[model samples]
Target: MPQISAFDVVGPIMVGPSSSHTAGAVRLGLAARRILGEPVTHADIGLHGSFAATHWGHRTDVAILAGLLGMSMDDSRIPQAKELADAAGLQYAFQTVDLGDVHPNSVRMRVLGKENSIEVVGASVGGGRICIYEIDRFEVEIDGSYTVLLARYKDQPGVVADITRILASYGINIAFMKVSRKTRGSDALLVAETDDPIVDDVLELVRQLQGGIVARRLPRF
Candidate 1:
């Protein structure tokens, strides 16, 4: 099959006018909000190539800020995302960046709040699709398709199996799983589109591991 561009995707189940540019950006923003773990008071965003050049024409900025505000992708408020963000007292800015060799449609968002500050870099692939290329300066890939589980444990064997077993015991089927590490420590990001919502017990079981530091239940909105 031939390769596809941001404008070539087609679908109706979406909440926006386009999938690749709008929906995908919104998802990225929402995921950023999740990682920040708090309502951001201010933000500085940088867009690359297509995103920086045509974000206004395509509402990419709106979708992005709306995600930070925890708004739905389809919400009409997206059109007035900046205004709404200002009204909500969230500080923000947008700019274009040159990422010569990187993907054409890419963005780096910096957000700040009284509670914390965070930076996230990701891309809108197409058809309102998003992939979190990096978080908190950590390089990892996360497709916002399911409730994601972020785990931190020692660099030992059976860590992956232990996590899977906990989910399996609760009959939770992991739709996707990706693992990464940096020197003595390892990280696991599990995205599960389960038959049932992720209950507390299932989450607690995974948290029981020695190196398990955090587990998040991220549902698609």
Candidate 2:
């Protein structure tokens, strides 16, 4: 038998009606926002499966917009997400899409900022829990259960070792680590989940690594 946690029993505290449709959608959006690491100027969101079939009635669209706008799931302003977005100068659109072989309640977001852009694909599994599967076309598995460190850099030998070494120097225990690259000796992405929060100083050290790496921290939800 699967062990049930408190979240499983009580579900998430949220504004929308359904956990899977509303809370999950909000989390998915938040994950994308964190990965982008900037204010969202424009967003092109694609809904799949159940999300595409009945998003309007469940307020999934509004929930997603609310998340992108940096609102929490329980925020009172979720129902007014569109209006809030307009006030914040955010432009967005949603469309149904075929995201092959993914969870039913999934979304793909292409978000643009003033100086950067990111493409994130993820799903809200249940109880407001989400799994971020892809970022910038790199396959990954991030569940937002721990503080996450994301680094993008030119593929090179010893890069992973150096990163782990930095974490070790700070006594930060790594809960999980995943590395993916487009091709040998090309661009790569590192996803490291830690048991403790990574302070800005540590993140800055990661940014100073060789190969012009760009590093960002995503706090646990």
lDDT of each: 0.74, 0.91
Q: Which structure among the candidates has the greatest lDDT? A: 2
Native-referenced Cα lDDT, model 2: 0.91
Taking the candidates one at a time, how many backbone clashes does each contain?
A: 6, 0
Model 1, span 1-221: residue lDDT tens: 98975545444355666676788888788878876767888889999888888887778888999999987666667778788898999988888888567677788989887866767889888766688776655666676656666555566788778887888888777776766666554543434444456778877877777774466565544
> In candidate 1, how many Å is residue 117 off?
5.1
lDDT of 1 at 199: 74
Cα-based TM-score, every candidate: 0.75, 0.96
**lDDT per residue (tens digit) for residues 50-116 in model 2:** 9999898899999999999998889888999999999999999999999999999989999999988
State model 1's lDDT: 0.74
Q: Candidate 2: list runs displaced more than 4 Å.
A: none
Candidate closest to the true structure, highest TM-score: 2
Instruction: Give the Å shift of residue 39 in candidate 2.
Output: 1.4
Badly placed stretches (over 4 Å) of model 1 are: 1-10, 13-19, 35-37, 112-118, 154-158, 186-196, 204-208
Give the per-residue Cα lDDT of candidate 2 at 175: 96
